[model samples]
Target: CSNKSGNKILYLHFDSLIIFHSITTISKVSVTAGKSVSIPCLYDSRYMNYVKYLCEGYYWNYCNYVVKTNKPDRSGKYSISDDKNQKIFTVTINQLTNKNTDYWCVVEINGGSDHGESFQLSVSSGKNSGGMKWCRLGRNCVTKSSGSIDGTTVTIHTTELNVFTVTMSGLKPEDSGWYWYIQIPVHLTVTEKLINSKYCKRS
Candidate 1:
């Protein structure tokens, strides 16, 4: 089961009468193409001395290493720093592109199971004049022209500065997951109401 508290997410798993808790700082992030973003990963105090790293992939077991606290990338595309006093580590990715999709903040365990939390990254060109589409992952996208989908209504408005604001109405509890704005994948949590929305840019 998963529970969200503020910007942190707690995931629980049970195996062999043991319980595991995985907490993540953020679930999703979006950046303009060619831009950079810094993601923060918070961990338990017990992992303060452990190795922390950022890996990229949709699956945890097969994610490719992007950067680590001990091994920083020489190419300068990625870097990680751990703040032992704060129990948090931050990963910075530069010159992001659309290909940067899923990633994980992982805490390494020497002789036991590792702990991790996954987050999705979305990149947009900000040069598409055709406006944008709001989509649920694996489902059809809803455009301003289309107006609605599956009992939900999505309205998009563009400003003179090319900034796009998307409003989603009639959200249910099941709508609480990943959604995309123009190619930007963002996580939205719906409880008594919609909790998050993204302001997209298109030129």
Candidate 2:
């Protein structure tokens, strides 16, 4: 899972206790709507025996667990496993859809607050899983290399099981096209609406 391109970014600071450090995870994980993904959560070597779980929710403060390493078979769509040797646990979710986007990797700290790191699991709906490409002025185009996207400052990352994140910044009218897993296209008529979710509002 660590062997990905420059698209993923690690969060140095998380919303937890001063002593409770969260696990290391991919900055952005992208996957197809129907594809499956295994999310890796790295923890402190001292807490190898601590319980690990995968939770899902729009709000980080009230995340609902989908699976745990202690109870792997409790959920049919989700399961978790821990490897003390690696000091990391993996959470696997099958048959993913748009609803299976936001998630958190949590560790139950002893006699203190729990540690966790949030991730954005963007489940895109695309049939073409090719490398990124860029088009200028809806004309000439070029094949893009990883971590070298043009205009939109795009970053595409992939881990074991094809999970990735398509993060695009600096949107422009000309920066429109089908750029592999992550695409940014301009719409003729744009109608904006205020989102009620905190995540969306922050975005």
Candidate 3:
């Protein structure tokens, strides 16, 4: 988590009560297909039984498990879990598709209350895409003199976002290479378009 101007950017999870003693922000995330991603959350207690806290909510939906109706809506796609004593709730999803779906995690606190957060799932619509690509200001993809490259490797601990903004400058002929990446285990969606030539120049 990074702090800018005394504001802490943290990802909220679906494990705890809706109301909190302190103001906590849930950082958005992107995930890929056929992988398990952890939806981030926080709580004020040391106990990890957040599934109990969810009982306060009016609705609880999980992988083929609906608390209210006992009937499956969409089977085998979601589930809930705990992580040590961190009060973090882990939501596991499997067999991702290209369907632009929005997942909702609703909760309640102070007895008979409710609140929610949502995450988006996006699939790659084009071929030959870049992963978390970096770009500079006023530069083409092949021009090394115009932009800088962050390369293809992603350091998970470096940035606290499922969404990354890529920017570069002075992209010269030598600057042609694969610049970005999207990790499936992290639930990420990447958007890429051609800035110059179809192929990167290796001057």
lDDT of 2 by residue, 103-126 (tens): 888887555556677777777887
Instruction: Indicate the residue-level lDDT of 156 in model 3.
Output: 23
lDDT, each prediction: 0.72, 0.61, 0.37
Candidate 3 matches the true fold with a TM-score of 0.37
- Greater-TM-score candidate between 2 and 3: 2
Top model by lDDT, which number? 1
Backbone clash pairs for candidate 1 read none
Give lDDT tens digits, candidate 3, residues 20-113.
3321213233555555444433333532332322121122233112221122225655555544454444455566565524554433332333
User: What TM-scores do the predictions have?
Assistant: 0.54, 0.54, 0.37
TM-score of 2: 0.54
Q: Which is superior by lDDT, 2 or 3?
A: 2
- Compared with the true structure, what per-residue lDDT tens digits does model 1 show for residues 67-111? 888888999999999878657687888999988878988897776
Runs of candidate 1 exceeding 4 Å displacement: 1-20, 127-203
Candidate 2: stretches off by over 4 Å: 1-21, 127-203
